[model samples]
Target: MDGLMPPPARPRPAFTDEELRTLVRPDRVHRSLYTDPGIFDLEMERLFGRAWIFVGHASQVPNPHDYITTRIGREPVIMTRDAKGAIHVLSNRCAHRGVSVCATDSGNTRHFKCPYHGWTYRSDGTLASLPQRRSYPHDRAEIESWMSLARAARVDEYRGFVFASLTEEGPDLETYLNGIRHSIDDLVDRAPDGEVAFVGGCSRYIIRANWKLQIDNGVDLHHATYTHVSTLDDDGRQFSRHGGGPRIMVDGKKSIDWEPFGVVGFPYGHGYQGRPPVETLPSGPVYEEYVRRLEARHGVDRTRQILNYDRFNSVIWPSMTFQAFGQHIRVVRPISVDRTEINVFPVALKGAPEAYNTGAIRSLAATHSAASMIQTDDIEVFERAQAGLQSGAHDWVLFAGHPGSEEPWHEGGWRGQGTSEFVSRIQYAENWISFLCGGNGNERG
Candidate 1:
């Protein structure tokens, strides 16, 4: 939970009703939100500063002294496992002369020693040692207090995924996750052992577009058929020219309708686009036996709910999106006004047959890897959009694919037609609310 203290009230620039309306036109968003450095700074301060952004999974640092360094908004932080087996999210900076404590991406370390000043901190972030004890006796307390790596305001875990809030006051992670909690559950539940762990290596890419562009792209199902045409072309012998051939079947029934992939938009800017089932999944006695075992363990209805749930990709607000069934998570980090860093993590389903986990990994690489043919093209499109927006030719981008087509709001959130941009709309709505209400509004459902 965020516990940030409120700043004294100042005469801030009131984003008037007209400006808010103009910024989030049903069909388009204002260009300033994407291209303005001032707006980008405010977003980092307001949105990322207050939201529960996913840092890394706890399994990534399973060992007692294992640690992983990552960004929480613009701040560099480390997720380290203490000797007592608890994880702490602390600033990577050293108290003595503000140098980074850990330089490598990740590894097992007994303690973090500042390369600059030889100050050391235990993996749990307490000051362990200083080079000279007698240098300043009375200042030892001040030095030690400063030497302890600054921890995050709050750190929490959902399933095994770790999230840290930069601020000191806000809703708990569960309250923020709302309807999207099911996505994480569905991912872990698919594992025969009811657990999932990061696998393979992470893929990192730099995109020359605003971070929101990447978020919008995740829920845009219609682009796949066009932008990823090369992937479909490569598999033309099996899939039809339009990227549709036959429905993948499981248990003598069609698994997904290729024509319509649904989208579900929840409060707090979380949402997902349903992914069509893979037609290439090997079917036969092996598949049947696996299904039978699952049915026996979870019952017919529960097993059906697990396997037949339509969503393929889910976006957790502000940052982090993953293809649950595909076993991959993407962390989006805003580098600047028009620059972003995206990290992709492949996951292995624990207790599932090795073959099944391998299949999921292969599928993730084929579709979402940094060097993926499909993903490369998608990045190019985003870059082109960024380039075009800079030319002053367009002032807004439309998100009104399904205007007047909102689904009845339910306990699970709003459902929409497969091709709709309602997910993006919902995200921007929450984004505006977060910026306007200072992280305390009742915008979360």
Candidate 2:
């Protein structure tokens, strides 16, 4: 009676780390990873909770009092630049009634006041006042804690990009980026002054598929050869028939029957496809003008490196997608197990000619926008993949497409053909497994 055996320990969790390990295999992944509602909630806790999630770029809130509302996992938050030019990410909920403190899509505001109650907070999220303060007990420490907006555990900026962590500890932004940072650097470096700016507006589309499918497909070129084949014009069709459309290659080798693309993979599922031959991009009225500016600022050789250097799609695992070639960026937001929202932002190179920026914008319009000639068809394929995955006809989605390559690490991380399962496999190994197990990122495949 004294010990009572403590009735054994109660298992607080409904699932365990062992169960999540079962969701992945060497060359295949279980379908539940795409369709399970419970798993989605767990990911919100584990994946988004611990990772350094991309909140917004510094340009989004450039001026004092400028702010934009967004979410980290399911937590509603606001990213605001204060009068002193420091950026802060504060929970959007009012401390009193749990109502949104600021409700417009985005704008400049000196302070936030809850509509439900009179609680007010400064731009830095410090509580200014609340109605009838005399009615409450004056415990200074307790009141200070309650009045202040809850902030993210950690916030850091890299190259004007801002990221926040819900958990207190993790690698800083630079470490999380690793090889993938080069893709972002190159994107802004292509600008004549070594900088780029968002064009102030973005196109958004609702994708009816899992968010993972969209990110994986962002770095995937094989699907474009099939899914967007219909959008090809007569000349475009001819080019496709000869295997000369959009492509991802490494070491000049991208043949289905041949060795796969030479790509780079890094920790946290971030990587880039082979650099495209941007030098061969069709010359235009503005092409010569853009080249002159680049050469003027960076010299001929550096400009050549910039022009010929092409990264088709640089994927930042979980959601963000960067494309150096298109001068466009994508942020994928997961709404549910089957729904994802993709925001596409068109960017411009600073100190470059007007014609150059306009051409890149036009190129994006024709191929990547909502009104894009090809994406409508591609969206259908994404939905179809979702429908098929939900059928449960196959327990695993196969990534076994690479021809013949070594299974071990290549150049520090696992890498192989453009279609190699190694990319996804290592993502699961280095990032997913460690994330699911709540480890310190030391776990390896």
Candidate 3:
């Protein structure tokens, strides 16, 4: 039996051209995108289905027979290192009786034994053994081709991060990643040893808001000063009331002005916010050392550009978001129209001083953790936004901040200054195209 199912009929267009144009004003977005279950389902099929959604890292399954299970879109997938050292991504369902082959989050096993029955499979997803050999008259050859575990249509890895797509056709991983590849490069390049390991346990939390809201907020720098004020205040520093006034610094230097940070929006929904280093100690020493090492390998000016580069958050089109300095990676898993599960992982510099990873974990936990003062406030606000969207008072929200104002494209894409919602606008633009065109043609705006 073919496992592929026909694409479901398209739902009524969630927003018309005029309505979407109004919804995503230069500075705001429509409220319906957050509350509408119909739009959310379309997103899973169009955006999530085509995008290179992050699977677990290769280091998570370093040894042969080691497996890590994760979700891609709504499908449960198993990523494993086979005896040949090749990584395979396959559906977790058993071919024999449609039972799940593996149930644990992760583990090492020579073969997968289906819990419902005695059917077993090798680490490579091939049929290994069944309970009775002669139960069926026409057995081994016929069963072999039919019983292998179902595999993802395509699987690819970049810088140790694994990704799988449900569709067999589309842009390859690199093309699809577009300009966002720099984020991955920066992640490894910043490591003293030019490599990173997935270290520390994952920190996960459920947010009661649409997944896109979380993504938009990740690149929204305007909130740092206001929403995160309590966090900074807890450290005994006060933000300047005046825009340019002197303020207490985390590292005894000038505080970041927030306005200088720029936002870049890419072709797909991918984008990033540029941030100057918070006046701090460790950055100078660590960055200088990293640059010197990079200079030795790639020479001077190039090393300067790579090491001294500033980026606040690097967001992948649909799910993953990276903060290279903080060594933080967040995976957004949409559970429903208004519910999202976010998993945060810390990257360890393979051969660098332990203090680097420790400091990163500490800072990440302090800022983004469930107990974080800043994150808690942001969560409450997002939840309130969701609740408000349920009201019929407003048909749309607006994204028109700084209308007709967008920066020129530099290397990867166009950049927008801080306080601009260009990032949010670009995201909705992509959403409009993907859903309306079914991941094909351009969207009419």
Candidate 4:
């Protein structure tokens, strides 16, 4: 009697179209959207499964046979460079029995051999060999075709940033990027060589909150006044390792007029905040030399435009965010309903002075790294939000700040005041629901 197996657990019913639509409204979102595991699973399927997700920078796999393993939603993937210099995003799972073939983060490996059965695949995702090949009745080509690592349905790059889609249909990478490509240009244009490399190894941290919480805070401007008040000096200026940044005082002390700086939101939940007016611009010999090199390639006027620190954190929603001026990239990886892992990679401008790149890497240590002041503060708030949303005390999470204050922005997006929540509102109202309703969720794009 003790050996009796328990009845199989019942599967939760899927959300209907109306239910999904109701979860996200124009001004607010239902609390259950954050606390429900079913919603997260659907997001991994509908949103990430169909949207163009960021894979990795092409610079990460520049050399032939170079491969880096990352995730596309819940699926493990390997971004590799073949002998022909073609980049491919291959599924990390082995074809036979679905064991992961690559375990390390990155390396130059010609073949990924499965540890379980010794089945190997080329960098291009072609099957190379397998143990006991003679046991199979099929010919070599058939076996190869069946057992090779599956490649992503589509892969493309924009300004060296690689993006992959699991489904073959939908818009191309360029079409999907919309105006966000300009933000990438802002980063690469600063590079004297017209290229940027993801240098210093990634700094990773886990947050006990829904992945959206991290992204929601990306373009948020008002949070700094209260949430990051601890990092501010007595004068209310936010201090980093290098020096002071914008001031964020909770009290009615001296504060920057952020509304004029502006925050813009684009299609597909992409957005960026205009760079807050800093206390001081980058100066000194290194910065001068950096500007001189930039001017030499492009004329003085062009260099000045390129060097203008206009955008702050450019968010490629649901996957990545980065700062062109700050010289770092943040890749968001969702682990589960209430867990997310963020990887911060410092960017090095190719052909720039070594000291400039090193300073960029060091600067991230004080702002975006795992132990950084700004990031830790944000993570705590995210966890607290997650804990609060778990209860049934509230039915909706508000995003109604500064309503009707937005203006038409470049490339058909909306620009709101610095303190507005328009970005998150559009994300939930338009894009999020479109995906959960089984569409591309790219009407605006």
Top-scoring candidate (TM-score):
4
Lowest lDDT 10-residue stretch of candidate 4: 1-10
Q: Give the number of the best model, judged by lDDT.
A: 4
Per-residue CA lDDT of model 4 for 50-136, tens digit only, reads 788999999999899999999988889999999999999998888889899999999999999999999999999988887888788
lDDT of each: 0.75, 0.71, 0.72, 0.86
Off by over 4 Å in 1: 1-22, 25-27, 137-144, 234-260, 277-296, 299-301, 409-411, 440-445
Give candidate 1's TM-score. 0.86
Rank by TM-score, highest first: 4, 2, 1, 3
Clash totals in order: 11, 2, 11, 0
Model 2, span 116-223: residue lDDT tens: 878888888888887888887877677777777778777898777788877766677778877788788888888888878777477788878877887667656566
> Positional deviation of 284 in candidate 2, in angstroms?
2.7
Candidate 4 wrong stretches, greater than 4 Å: 1-13, 139-141, 250-254
Candidate 4 accuracy as lDDT: 0.86
Model with the higher TM-score, candidate 3 or 4: 4
> Which parts of model 3 are misplaced by more than 4 Å?
1-29, 133-142, 234-257, 281-304, 440-445
Instruction: Give me candidate 4's TM-score against the actual structure.
Output: 0.95
Clashes of 3: 11
lDDT of 1 by residue, 181-244 (tens): 8889878887666788987778888899999888888777777655655544333422421234
